[model samples]
Target: MDLTDTVAVVTGASSGIGEATAKALAREGCSVVLVARREDRLERIADEIESDRTLVIPTDVTDEDEVTAMVEETREVFGCLDILVNNAGVLRVDPVAEADMADFREQVEVNLLGAMNTTHAALPVMLESEHADIVTVSSVNARHPAKEGSAYTATKYGVNGFCRSLRKEMADEQVRVTIVMPGPVDSEMRDWENWEGRALEPTDVAESIAFAVSRPEHVEIPEITVSTTDKLR
Candidate 1:
């Protein structure tokens, strides 16, 4: 699908890969909707891009009502939606036995449920479009679990399952579903201090996302895994 003139809603657009994706899409001539709890950050990003090509919507994806309103406002402003990037996520790293229940809940709410809320709310508008795409920023942890990161990995696993199932359901609808899994990246969500190898930059993942959505209307990129060569598994 050509990104020119297309409208894309990118959740967690406040920072990291989400931020990069919003900018990348804008550069591709897309009308990008920046969604995140940080209105100020969203506004800052919006200012850097063409104002008319971006809409800043301060939203908490965990809230179903806010997510619904987000989609409604996007339609109200852009008239149609072409891409939905479910990128809002949180990571609470701890062993299962000692993990805080609240932290676990937070991860599940933001990483898993939040994606569902936006997808559910945006499906109608997307299906109405000539061609649409649902691209999710998942993690390599979804496939390879780590010892101390059970909760975070679980949420990603859930996200992976959801996207795969949704992809099958939308196979005949001209709506493409894709999952971009990245290894450790230097972002707000990760601390690279303890790492031995260089991490992939947010723009690396962003470029992958841009490539996936830019495919021909007949082709669908099911998944893309990006990681630094030194960081195995």
Candidate 2:
């Protein structure tokens, strides 16, 4: 699990947790691939990292074809895949009875299915590495439901289930699966500026993710729940 010279792909690299993760991994000397729908933003983030070790591949995780191609390009360019950070997600706040079906569907597609698409496409390449890690960014909502956020919570719950199942299935394999759940974060997806309690910064979660993957090979950190001390229950 020495991140030095290892290859890592981070989705949703355009902003927030993904951006911080890309920087954090780079600091650990891992080569990073940035994937997001915004090519321009990716380019900007790329400039802040070690250019020699950074690759920007604009991708829509919801599209299986695009995700598959992204993995292929990563392997072709980097020669191996050691880490995958499935951080791409969207949030829609609304009650089920009054919710827009389209919004709910998009949330499911981007938050749940997007992780599946990336995982499916990256598995084969990741297996070749001596040790690999798949870190998915889930939410506390997966375990605790939220008002006007049932649709969003549903998607997180689905992803949590998928990751847990995959973790058991891959237990004997070299790949390690870890789920990172953050209580509330000030990110592009949500505005926590007015919250009465403290909110986690993206780097806080990034460090948690980095810590998860940097553990000794035999020590598995299956899940991490990060929340502000004053967070509302």
Candidate 3:
């Protein structure tokens, strides 16, 4: 569908794929609502965009009230919500047996529960629109678990499952749901020692999201797995 004048809410928009996706959508004539904890960065990115139709909502996705407020504010500012991108995530690497349970809980809270919180808030708004889409950023680790990354893997795996079930429930509403699995993206979250060489750029993943949202109304791209050609197993 054409993104002209469509409204999109992007989580984790302070940097990385979320920031890139916000800019990409803006370039496509979509009015984007950028949600993140950093107000200064969000404003900076908003200023950088060419569109006059960007709203920066400083929000913590894990907070239900903030997420609900974000959804309400987006509707008030943009008039309609066409897309929701659940991209907020965190990673902690350690052997499952030796890792701190608190760290594991933190990862689960942000990666899994965070998405759920945002998605739950956005769903009602999306249902009221003519056509809507939900795109989630998952990791390849969801399917290919690493020895030292069990907690991270578990959260991603849970996100994948949650989106799948949500898609089935929303199918009749004409709300398209897509899950993107990217491998070793070159971001601040990656550790150089564990992940070396060229990794997928944040913009590359943003492009995937743009492509999925830009497809014809009758077309639904459910799942996309992207990895560096060199990293292919």
Clashing residue pairs in candidate 2 are none
lDDT tens digits, residue span 1-233, model 2? 67898999999999999999999999998999999999999999999885688999999999999999999999999999999999999987766899999999999999999999999999999999999999999999888777788888999999999999999999899999999999888888874333578788999999999999999999889999999897665
| Residue-level lDDT tens digits of model 1 in 1-233 | 56888999999999999999999999998999999999999999999886587999999999999999999999999999999999998887776899999999999999999999999999999999999999999998888776678888898999999999999999789799999999888899984333578788989999999999999998899999998988653
Q: After superposition, how far is residue 219 of candidate 3 from its true place, in Å?
A: 0.7
Stretches of candidate 3 exceeding 4 Å from the true structure: none
Model 3 / residue 110 / CA error / Å:
0.9
Residue pairs in steric clash, candidate 1? none
How many clashes show up in model 2? Answer: 0
Q: Which residue segments of model 1 deviate by more than 4 Å?
A: 192-194
Best by lDDT: 2
Give the C-alpha miss distance for residue 142 in model 2, angstroms: 1.0
lDDT of 3 by residue, 45-128 (tens): 999995689999999988899999999999998888999999998888887788999999999988999999999988998999
Which of the two candidates, 2 or 3, achieves a greater lDDT against the reference? 2
How many pairs collide in each candidate, listed in order? 0, 0, 1
Worst 10 residues of 1 by lDDT: 190-199
